[model samples]
Target: MFHVALTGLLTGLALIVAVGAQNAFLLRQGIRGEQVLPIVLTCLLSDVVAITAGVAGLGIVLERWPSVLPVAQVLGGLYLIAFGIHAAMRAWKPTALTTEGGASLTVGKAIVLTLALTWLNPHFYLDAVLMLGTVANSFGEDRWWFLSGTLLASLLWFFGLGYGARLLRGLFARPSAWRVLDSGIAVLMGVLGVGLLAH
Candidate 1:
């Protein structure tokens, strides 16, 4: 059981460590110190639901649906591309800093954006649901333990990312720093989208 859980935790972390739109967004939110808790919680909960679905056989079921994959892939790719363009525009357009707190982006927007960023990507299903589920299934009776470990990993990662950026808020206060960050996010999203389309 211990070995199974360890394997699952490591596997989950390994899958998540890759730079993606979701991670980029979380880091930005952290740096801005805006809607941090809600964003983190939404991401964590979404992962829990996704991973649970995988463990419950939804992954395999989805895999069997070939038509659905391509559609999801296209939608996800397009969404990423759109988001990348938006970020790029923000980077290109310099904005004046306001002392009356940062511009109100709203928690609702953050949650929606986070969900779209995380869930819209079909790669998420491939990694979090399909791949993880397949591996967990290999454990037979110990699969539940493996799922628990994976969940723990997800929780730790989201919380760390969401709160960790707050530590850098001071650095991000500079307009130039925000431009760089936004530019990086734009590039990442575009690259990921292109990669998805190619695959």
Candidate 2:
């Protein structure tokens, strides 16, 4: 059981550590210091759902559906490219000292955007659900223990990412810092999209 739990924890972290839209959004929101708690919780909850589905064998079902993969990949790729372009455009634009003047994003918008960022990516389902589930299968009935560990890992990571940004809010308040952060995100997102296309 301990081995299973350890494997799950590491696997969960490894799967999530990649550069992707969801992580980019979380980082940006953290920098912006807007609705951090709700955003983080939503992300974590989303992970919970996906991970649950994967552990429960839903992932295997989805993976076997050949028609779904291409469409999902296309949509996910397009969305990533669009978001990357938008972020890059923002970086190119003049910076304001106080972004607080802009209209804050509503909870509904945040939730929708988060879902798109997370669920729309076929790769997300592939990695977190399908791949992880397949691996968990090796544990037999002990897969439950593995999944519990993975779920806990997700909770820890999301909370750390969401709330952790608060510590750097002062730096993000600086125009130069914001510029660097946004530019980095733009570059990361663009590269990820390009990689997806190549794959």
Candidate 3:
């Protein structure tokens, strides 16, 4: 069980650390310190449910019906492209951001955005729901340990990212820093979105 859980922990970390909409948005919210708790909680819970659902057997459906992936890719790719453009525009504007206090988003808006950033992306389904589920089931009865590890990883990353962001408050305080960060996010999203569509 220890070994299985450890394997799942490492694997979960690997998958969650991917460059995606979730990370980008988290960084933004973290730096701003706006609705951090609610956002983080939402992300963590969403991940838990998604991972649990995957382990419960959603992966089998995806594997059997491969066409679902392409459809998701098309939708996700288009959304990513649009999001990327928005980020790029923000970069162009280059607003100064402060971790202590700044323009805070309403809790409702934050929740909606969080869900969209998490659930709308096809990559989330492919990686979190499909890949992780398949991997967990491979362990048979030991699958629960794998799921636990995944849950732990999600907890650590979300909390660390959401709270630890304060450490970078000084850096992100500058408008120039926001410009650079947003620019990178924009480029990443645009490229990945295009790749998904092309693939």
TM-scores for all candidates: the values are 0.93, 0.91, 0.92
For each predicted model, how many residue pairs clash, with residues at least 3 apart or on different chains?
0, 0, 0
lDDT of 3: 0.85
Comparing 2 and 3 on TM-score, the stronger one: 3
How far out, in Å, is residue 65 in model 3? Answer: 1.3
- How would you encode candidate 3's per-residue C-alpha lDDT over 1-199 as one tens digit per residue? 9999998899999999766788878888787777899989999999899899999999889889989888888887888898899878877763433344334579998998788778777888888899999999999999999999999999999999888887887898777787888889899889988988998
- Clash pairs for candidate 1: none
Choose the strongest candidate by TM-score: 1
Native-referenced Cα lDDT, model 2:
0.79
**Candidate 2 Cα errors over 4 Å, as ranges:** 95-103
Tally clashing residue pairs in candidate 1.
0
Candidate 1: residue 171 Cα off by (Å): 2.2
lDDT of 1 by residue, 1-199 (tens): 8999999899999998778999998887777777889999988898889888998898889878867778878888989999999888877776623112345569899999999998899988888899998999888889999999999899899889888877887877788887888889899999888877877
User: What TM-score quantifies how close candidate 2 is to the native fold?
Assistant: 0.91
What overall lDDT goes with each candidate model? 0.85, 0.79, 0.85
